[model samples]
Target: MLLQLDIFNILIQGGKGLKPLAYRMRPQKIEDIVGQQHLVGPGKIIDRMVKARLLSSMILYGPPGTGKTSIASAIAGSTKYAFRTLNAATDSKKDLEIVAEEAKMSGTVVLMLDEIHRLTKPKQDFLLPHLEKGSIILIGATTENPYISINPAIRSRTQIYEVKPLTEEDIKQAIDRALADTENGLGKMNIELSSEAMTHLTQATHGDLRSTLNALELAAKSTAPDTKDGKVHIDLAIVEECLQKKALVQDKDGDAHYDVISAFQKSIRGSDTDAALHYLARLLEAGDLISVNRRLLTIAYEDVGLANPAAAARTVSAVTAAEKIGLPEARIPLANAVIELSISPKSNSAISAIDAAIADVRQGNYGDVPDTLKDAHYKGAEKLGHGTDYKFPHDFPHDWVKQTYLPAKIKERQYYHAKENGRIEQAFKKQYDLLRQAQRK
Candidate 1:
């Protein structure tokens, strides 16, 4: 009991009266690092590189909170070389040159540059020559696609390692560790995490460890004073208030923008109106105009095709209205369009049928156009009888001719198969069946 009290006191005082809780939780060795065992696992590429002291210039590309910075720090810690850090967002070309001169004078240097994609072309070029000479080993971290954002020359020299987002298991383990750690964590508080709270935090964070930790920290602090019998029960209501409502919502320009939009599309596809509306509200709150417009356009065809052909037309009209009206007034039409398309019945194979037919023709399944449909306007057309077998549909009953329109090679091919659900497609099916039946007789 006394030992536990001392541990709690030490944690409350912030780790030997020096390091804070966040710093105390920082991994000291590579093995202590969580979530990225694939890269730093025993005998893996990174482990082999570190063991052999053959660390190459490399880029760590992944979404935020997947341990890119931590891995780079671990590499530097494990190495005998001097370590230096800089942010490309604030550091200039001169700053890089200064580091280069120091590296030349002081022997090997490992320069870990955060947000390397933010560096200008010249700044990136400044590091190229030094990198080639082995005076400095570059470790760059970026959230963007490196091929499009990084300098091509710099990219060619450096090896790229992609870090994946942490799994739900990873996030759960991290939270548990934070709660149990005596130093720099809520060691003294017996905080109970409700299942709903845990699930909500995991989903809301979108695989960001930093955000998750911050959220847990906030939740604990907020619930600390409300404890009873040395146990604080954190319910869904507490989590929703402390984390969800004030969590900065997901910004369209921010890191989780793509994730939120993907969730929105999936919700509509799954026919979950509640989930779809939640994402819609997030996007609308963020003021993401182009993304909203683009998604509405896709939803029109992908989710509302043929069922209500007017949905696509309405979506296009909404886009035009958005352009002319521009927000406040435009938001109304956009919201209406999104709701209309989301709730509307859906069909997809209408477009897929045409695509399949084209593929068949390209593969030589259909060799040529029918003789009746061939051009007869040329000078020598009379001798070849291009239009000789043609029968005008107007001359037949119901303005339709009982004839084969397909080429000889693919005369029996049937590409389109209409769905029986939508009203629009039913009409097409009736007319098509009648025409084919008459042609057969």
Candidate 2:
């Protein structure tokens, strides 16, 4: 096996670096890993295997940037094994033979086979004997569900474990590590990442650690140091530029930032087409396409709600279309949605009702689920009085039954107070009033 390249030192010594911050900052030991405590935490499955020196061929499947490759690296680091990587999808059978030959001679080489589900039959045949003999410890990494995507032949020989998406804290921890490690990170530089910038990084990528680190690195390099402080102050703008999404002219979470979004939503809720269009243009001009989609969707269900169900549905379609095509052209569908939502009948009945119910739940003004509404599938369910006297609504003439589904204490509590904003809502209110009267009686 070839020696692992030290791209970090190469860059410091005036060489063109090849490896990314994510690859360079990979955990050298299992303990150094940021997250996935269920597998890599102290005395966890992977940890136990590493500590006992009894590593087995295993499949790690999960979303990308969730540390599947990092797990393989950490295992190799912990075990002091010769680690070699090859893409099963692109690499040929000859590549597998080379790794196998090395494993035979080198003793227990860790072969991190990427896209393991894409391993062709010929390559699988070549690699199986080596895996069976315990010469090569196969660490198969893939994004697909192994049970469904992987061949049974490979599945039978490997223990499968999921690598879950990183939590916000996990991504933050990794970022801190990369920013602090002088040998492999940007520790030498005077860089200060702002709080809102950090939040943007953590939330915008949706639990992707790789994207966060890379974005951070990009911000650090691209942003110039402050003349007065001599610190590279990476704020939301620089971070957004690095992300290529989440654009903000005003500092994120600032008064002006909140004001713009607040006014945008309120204008739509107030049914002012001109004002809504103006705010929409401001947001679009600032290049915050994501924020536009989010607020519009919220307004669809929250503001335009049950008053015009079809209009709200159309708003969703508009948002989806805008997201696919993006801005300039996205402005068209977004404008159409704005106009329809502004001119259409509006209602806050659904949002108000749900919020009221949520408040009660939060206050602990509830009780245990009634036995009549409890599951009766199990053998002892009837003995426990579960499903006892439970009426099947479908068996009734109107497909309706006068039975409480809520917990005992909250049986009479109403959550959905329908409005008379539109014909549909009026009809719903009529049905709801009738149902409540019968049930209460």
Give all candidates' CA lDDT scores. Answer: 0.75, 0.85
Lowest summed-lDDT stretch of 10 residues in model 1? 1-10
Q: Candidate 1's residue-wise lDDT over 28-111, tens digit each?
A: 567767788889899988888889999899999997787887787788778767778899999888888888888979978989
Instruction: For residue 107, give model 1's deviation from the true position in Å.
Output: 4.0
Best-fitting candidate, scored by lDDT: 2
List candidate 2 stretches off by more than 4 Å.
1-18, 34-68, 79-81, 100-179, 188-304, 308-348, 351-390, 401-410
How much is 78 displaced in model 2, in angstroms? Answer: 3.3
lDDT of 1 at 431: 82
lDDT for model 1: 0.75
The local distance difference test score of model 2 is 0.85
